[model samples]
Target: MLAIINDDLAGAGRPESIFISWLLWQPRGVDLASEALKEVQKLARYEKVDPDIARLKALFASLAGSDRSMH
Candidate 1:
């Protein structure tokens, strides 16, 4: 998933822990602690949703379903 550190993600003097909140709401946000693979500040500057993020959400949903095959 492409991670973008736009203004929303980075507030003025925003604590690092804030990322935890974002991840909590978005279960697909994996590997957030590592160095960002992609940072499109401009791309996320005007919008809230990004393509990579949407795909990640879909991927996470599939993974969740895969884990529940026993039922």
Candidate 2:
């Protein structure tokens, strides 16, 4: 099961796919918060207006800025 997921991530290239890949990596000790933060900025710069995306960007910004030790 994990092997299949790894294989998919290894081949994914779409922006959303890459984001999902980063999300999956986060739980495995990978520090994806920075990447997520950058992605949020990219979305905002491009004028993406989806409320959900905006909310996600805000969440990512908060996560990226917050001290991890507190969590």
Q: Pick the candidate with the highest lDDT.
A: 2
In the predicted model 1, the residue pairs found to clash are none
* Tens-digit lDDT track of model 2 for 1-71: 01112345455543345445557666665577676566556656533555444444565565578532111
Per-prediction backbone clash count: 0, 0
On the 0 to 100 scale, the lDDT of residue 21 in model 2 is 57
Against the true structure, candidate 1 reaches a TM-score of: 0.27
Off by over 4 Å in 2: 1-21, 26-30, 46-48, 66-71
Deviation of model 2 at 12, angstroms: 17
TM-score of 2: 0.43
Error of 1 at 6 (Å): 13
